[model samples]
Target: MTSQRAVERGASVLIDAGSLTRCRHRLYLDTAYSALLRQEPENPGVRQRREAARAQREDIRSRLSETLDGWTEIEAPDARTASELTMAACRRRVPWIWNAVLPIERTTGRRGRSEILMLDPVDGGYIPIIVVNHKVTDPGRGARTSRLTEWAPAVDETRKVRSQLRDQLRLAHLYRMLDFEGIASPNAHGGAIGYRAECILVHDLTTVFDEYDARFLDRLSVARGESFTVPSQVSECRSCPWWTDCRPQLVANRDVSLVASGMRADALREQGVSTIDELADFSGPEPDNWPFGSFTDAVAAATAWRAGVPLLRRTDEVTVHRADVEVDVDMESYQEHGAYMWGTLLTEKGGPPAQYRGFVTWDPLPTVDEGRSFAEFWAWLMGKRADAAARGKTFAAYCYSRAAEDKWLLDSARRFGDISGVPTEAEIREFIDSEQWVDIYQAVSDQFICPNGKGLKKIAPVAGFEWRDAEAGGEASMGWYREAVGYDAEPDTTQRERLLVYNEDDVRATKVLREWMSDRAEIEIPTLESLRSAV
Candidate 1:
C-alpha cells in the first residue's frame, strides 16, 4: 500500500487527508481507538465498498499516467520521504510530478501525498491536482475544464460542476500542505480529475480555506488532548469504523440522537437536554435555538422513544391514500451505474390474486442493455396505468421515496427514448406530479412520528412486516449485486434469486406498511396527545 493509503486505514494520531471531512468525533475516536488498541469492527459491506473505490482509483491513476507521457512517477519507496519530493520540485525540469509527497507540516501536524503537481510557469511553486474515483461533473455547460493532455489550463466548458464538499475539502487539505512548503501556486484554485477522466475540474478554494483551517485546528485539538468531543450521531456514522463502538454508547444513554441526529441533537445538547427522558419532560417555553418548529411533536417523539414504542401517531387517526387499482413500486440500482430492476406488486379488490412482476437485467451496468431493461420496466408500469384507465378504476402507484425512483425514471426514459416503450421526460414529470403517483414516505412523515428512524427498514417492522432474507438491506444487496452480475467473479445464480426476493419483499413491505397506516395505526400506535399527557 502507498503511504497515503496506509493513513486512510486509520491508526495514526496526526491529521492527514480526508480526516477533516469526516465527523469531528470520529476524528477524535481515530486517535482514542488507536491509543486504546481497540479494533475497528470488521464489516464485509464496508470492505466491499472500499475495495471497489480503491480499484476505481487505481484504474484512473494508471490510465491518467499513460496520458502524461514524459512526466515522472516517483517510485512508492522514494515517495515516502519529503526530501526526495522537495528536491524534485526544486529541480522543476518537468512540468508535472506524479505521486509526490508533501513535507510534514509540524506546526499543524499535517502530512499528505498528491496524485499530480503542475509546476507554475510564472513561479517556482506548483499547483496540486487530485484524481478521484467518482464523477465530478454532470452533462451541461458551466464548469471550467481542460484536455487530459499535459498540465493544461482549465479552459474547457463542456460540463457543469458537481459541488462535492468532500472533494473540495480533500483538495483543500493537499493545498494546505503545499502552502506550508512555500511552493503552492499563488492562486487558490486546485485541479481534480473525476470519473470522467476526460479533463481536469477546477475548484476555487478561496471560499473553503476558512472552513479547512477551522476544521484542522479543531481536529488537532482532539488529537493533542486540548479539547474533548463525545460521539454524536451523524449521517457519516453509517459507514464509520467507530459505529460499533459509539452506537452502543449512544443507545445506552438514550442519546437525543436516537431520535433527532446531527444538528438537531447538537442543538438539544446545547440546551442541557442530552437524553430522551430530558427532552420528553420539557413542558416550558421552547429554547431559542430549537431546531424544529414543533417542540410538542419533538417532545412526543422523544416520549415514544423513552417508552420503547417504535411509532407514535401525529393525531388520533392515521389515513393513507388507497386506490381501487393500486401498484406498489420499488427500484434496485447498483450505485449510479443504472437502475437494473423495477419490482411491482399489483393489488385490487375482487381481482386476480396480486401478482409480482420484476423487470431486470443481469448485464453489467453502464452497458446499453440497461436501456432495454429500463424501457421494459417503464413500458410495463405505464401499461398498468393504461389498464386502470380502461377499466375506469381509480389508480395510484406507491413508492417509499421519489428521490431514487423519480431520478432513475427520468434518467432511463431520457437515455432510451429511441427504444420502443420508453416514456418522454414530460410524460414522466406529469405522472410523477399527479395524484396518481404517491410517495408513501411523505405520507408516513405527515401521519406518524418514528423515534428510532423513519427508514423503510425501521418503520416497516413497526407494521409487523419482516423480510424473507435475513440480510435484506440496500448495503447488503449491493454486495450481492456484484456476485449476481459477475462484476469481479463468476455470476452466481443464487445471488440473482436473492436479489429478486429482496426486491419483491421491499414492494410487499410498502404495501403492508401502507395498509397498516390506514387500518391499524390508530389502535396500535400511541397518540401524540397521549404522549404529551404522560409527560
Candidate 2:
C-alpha cells in the first residue's frame, strides 16, 4: 500500500527501492494486479530466502543498535505528510529518521510517490542510509543518487512543512546519506564503510520529477485499461510477472528481440529487420548502418539465430594446453556471506571418467569457516599437481569463469591463510596467469557463438551433459545452503547432500564443454543448410 493509504489505515508500509525505480508501465501493471487480483503465493524457496534475508538484516541492525545511541522510531501522521516533513527537515538540516517514509504525491508528477530511507547514527546527527544485502565496492553511483532524489520533495512547501515539524516537536539536522553494504570485510574497520551520495546530482531530480509528471499519468491510464505492452527486452521479459503470457506471443511472432539481446532489437527494427526469418534471409553485404558494428558480424548473428546456435565470430579462437590430467572446478558461493564449498572433478586420459571431491564448511554463521575450507581445497589441489608432475603429465584446472574463483581464492588467502599453510600472493598470481588455469567460458566465447546464451546450464545440455537434479540452479543451491546451515532451524543433511550434488554437476558441465571443445578443431558452426537437412 502507498504510505498515504497505510497512514490512513493506521498500518505500516514497506517500500522496495528497486521496484520503485522500474519502468512506469511495469510498476503500474504490477500495482494494478496487486490491487485487483490476488497474487499467487511466492515459491516456497523464494519465500525462505527472503525470510532468511530479513533475519540477517535484523541481526545486523541489532548489533549496530548496541554500538550506537539516540535512535528512535516514530509513527508519521500520514505517508504524504511524513514525506513533506522529511523534505522540510532535510532542507533545514534536521536529524535523521530511522525507517523514515517519505511520500511522493501523485499530484507531484512522479513515478514512485513514496520512498523509505533508513538512517545510521552519527555524532550529534544522523546520516541517511541505504542497506544492500550483497558485497560490492561500488553499487552504481547513479542508482544511489536516484534513490536520494526519490526521498527529496519536488514542490516547494518549506515554510508550511517546517511549521508542521516545529508544531510536532520533531526537528533535527541530517548530516548526509550513505550506503551500508551488507557484506562483511576483514579489511573494513566495521562490517561496512558508509558511501556518501553525490549531492550535486540531486539537482537533476527536479527534471526527472517534471518528466514523470508529463508521462506517468498517461502510462497509468494505459495500465488500468489493461493495454500495457509487453517489453521487447529479454532481461525485462525474464523479470516480468507477465512473462508466461507474453513469451508465447513473442515466440509465435518471431520477434527480432528473441534473437537479439539488449537494446539492439530497437535498432534492428529501425533497419526494417523485425523477424528471425527476415534477419536470416537478408543476403546484402554488411550495411554501413549496421548497429552490430560489421556486416559480417550481423550476418553471423543472423545465421546463428536461424540455426538456433551460438554465433562464433570469425576472429574468435579457443585453445587449451594439452594435459594428461585435467580438473574441472566450480565453487558454490553465498554472496550474502562467503564461498562455502569448492567442488572439483578430476579426469585423466585413458583413466577414470570423473573423480568428484568437495571441500565444504558446515557452519551457517558468516565467519572464517569458508577460508578454512578454501585452504584445505587448495592444499589438496597442490598435492594433485605435484603427483601429476611426478608422473611427467601436465595438470590443469578448468573453470567456466576465472573471476569468481580467482577472487574467492585471493580473498580467502588474505583473510585466513598463514605464512606456511596457504599459497602466497605470488604463487596464487602465477597459478592464475599460467596455462595451468583454463577458463573455458573465455575459450567458448573466443571460439564459438552461443545465441541461446553463455550460462553453463544453457550450453552444457547441447554438449550432451545433464544435471541429475532438474530443479538445481544457483538460487536453489543458495536455499539449500541456508537450510544446511540451519538459518531457520536445525541443519538438514539432505539439503547439504543436495547442495554437493548440484555443485558437482556444475563442474561436470564445465568438463563436458571442455571435452567438446577439445574434439572439435573447427568449432561446429550451425548453418541453415545443416539445420534444414537434419530436420
TM-score for all models, in order of appearance: 0.90, 0.72
Winner by TM-score: 1
Candidate 2 segments whose C-alpha is farther than 4 A from its true place: 1-25, 35-37, 43-56, 75-94, 109-127, 136-228, 282-299, 308-319, 418-420, 520-535
- How big is the positional error of residue 40 in model 1, measured in Å on the Cα after superposition? 3.8
Full-model lDDT, candidate 2: 0.57
Q: What digit string (tens of lDDT, one per residue) describes model 2 on residues 1-535?
A: 5756634332222223333235544655565566533565555455655675556556545544554344333357776766565555544444334445444323322222111233322322223343324432332322222223223323322111111111111111111011111211111111111112222111222223344333434544444443455546456554456667667877788777776745566667777877877876777654445565344445556667766665453443445555888998898877546788999998988896689999999987467676677788898888888999999998999898788998877766766766346677777888888889988888766665566667888778777789999888876777788789887789999999999889899998998777776665345644434544665
lDDT (Cα, tens digit) per residue for candidate 1, span 425-531 = 99999999999999999999888887777899999988999999998998899889999999889999899999999999999999999999888888888786776
